[model samples]
Target: MLGDDRGQSNLDFLFGISVFLLTFLYAVTFIPGMFTPYQPGAIDLSAVAYRTSAMLAEDPGWCNSTAAGGLPGNSSWEDHQDCLLRIGLAGDRGHPNILSLNKIKALESLVASDYTLVREKMGLNGSIIYDINVAVEMNGTSLINAPWPSASSQNIESIERVVLIDTGKELFVDCNNPGEQYNSNMLNVTLNNLTSRDRDITIRIYNLTAAYPIGLAQDPIRVVSLSGNAISLPPDDYIIKLNGEVKNSTDFGFMKGDVLEITILNTAISDPIISAVNIWANSSCMPGRPVDYVYDPVFKQKSVCYPGIMRVEVWSYAFS
Candidate 1:
């Protein structure tokens, strides 16, 4: 009789089916999902914040405005509008984590003009609403105070970067002292102790005003040794290197307020000796300081380095 009862009752069949369905659902809870796509739009706030911070702290930005004259390095913050491609504080690629004060000021100006535009430049959109804040401190002073819009969102992210600030201070080398002027025959640059005599020396001269140093001074100038000997220059804009020999480019192409740099390698000469740096130039653009009342080291030639901080804050609404 038990062998003949092979088929299950209708009630039993329904109960068995219910148990199978419940088991399948329970197994699903333990199994790992394999088909779910990652949604960056849902949780990319931290990523955006980090990316933005890297852009400003590590990358050098570029500009292409008409007012900038197609040279990003030559343009100041006040010169161009909506032409900067990236918003970075770095001075150059070689100096990562270094900031440029000019670039900072330019970014501040851009934010003042249009927040939406600046956001777009940073690759932010409506879906990812954000707030940006930047503060730069140099020499225990605040160089920038760019604050974010007043918002009540509790979700905020930040990144602090230690960096060096480039002030781009003008090099003031006084070829002549006050009250005493050198005649048109020669401008003497006396290196009192001339320690690096065996090196190749480079001197750059700029003739334009510091504010606008684009126009070249049409001054006929030549470099000469103490004994009235001439130093030849390269035909084009190229760097001078020494291979146990002193080689330099004479095309200084100095504009008013422009900078002239002189470098001497230790391997170029046989011995260290005191020498006179003689410059022969037009009378109109002599070695005297055209604009006075500014007092600083006239013999110093270098960019001013300042301690700076880069703080990047990112925010978004959790509900959004």
Candidate 2:
């Protein structure tokens, strides 16, 4: 009896060992497959569904409008009319990268292809609103109009244009232009031009609250400086100095009703030559209603249903 009991105990121990060994081997093999970099919903021969349900769950508003059919069927005149204005203003302009209404529509279409609406809210003001956020790569492209050739004799171009934090403060003007000139002796021309016009070439930053002043010096909130083509300003939080004095962020913040004026003055010549000015801001801040409501026009009026204010922040850099 004692021998039989001992034999039974030994058999039970072996069985336990075998079960553990099988489980260990199975785990070692299965874990690697589970952790494979390929997504489970990826197009594999074994995958029954090629489309991922999670992709469908994302918000459709996040899609790229240009990639999708022009406009969604549900869009209203107010929603789609602004696009018409953008296209009109940008039509065949040398700069192809400006954000036009067509581009906005394309963005919407791209969003629809990958995502579906989960929830949306209608504001009291009769605006259809969304709280959707989408993750996208920063392609390092400017959404605003690209700076054109300097209308002035001196060539200055604005680079790294981006909208900073939204403050309700109004802006008068924000403009950036890059310019260049060719001469028989490139090195001599560059050196002589720099020496002569270095002090006269002033970049004037302004925050205009009323109509954009037709002349440069007529603006109210303005900061002027004379420097080389590239100028780097020191970093100070919440305060931006225009001349030598510190001022409020609202004085320079990019906001609704605010404008940025970039004036490049070529002092080398008898009369200082001023370059062209570029304008940008939420269209809602414009003083008057959209001029024309046709399928295409230069300016489109947008309702400030979401963000009620415009904010501007300026940073200066020197290019090589």
lDDT of each: 0.55, 0.26
Best of the candidates, TM-score = 1
TM-score for each predicted model, relative to the true structure: 0.47, 0.20
Model 1 over residues 1-320: C-alpha lDDT tens digits? Answer: 45675777899999999999999998897554332325445655567778988887777765665553454353232344556555667877778887877777777777776777777667665565677776778867787655447646777777787888976643344433454443333444554444434334444444333333222223223233546565532223223222213234444344443455434333322232324444444343445432221222454445656777777777767433
Residue-by-residue lDDT tens digits, candidate 2, 1-320: 45544345788999999999999999999998775648542222112111111121111222223423666432222234322211111112333222233333333443354222221211101122112222211234222232211223222222221212111111221222112221111011111223233222222233333354222111222212233332222222112334434443323444323333222223322223212112223222322211121121322222111111111111111101
What root-mean-square deviation over C-alphas does model 1 reach?
A: 17.7
Worst 10 residues of 1 by lDDT: 213-222
Full-model lDDT, candidate 2:
0.26
Model 2 lDDT-worst window of ten = 182-191
Off by over 4 Å in 2: 1-21, 24-133, 137-320
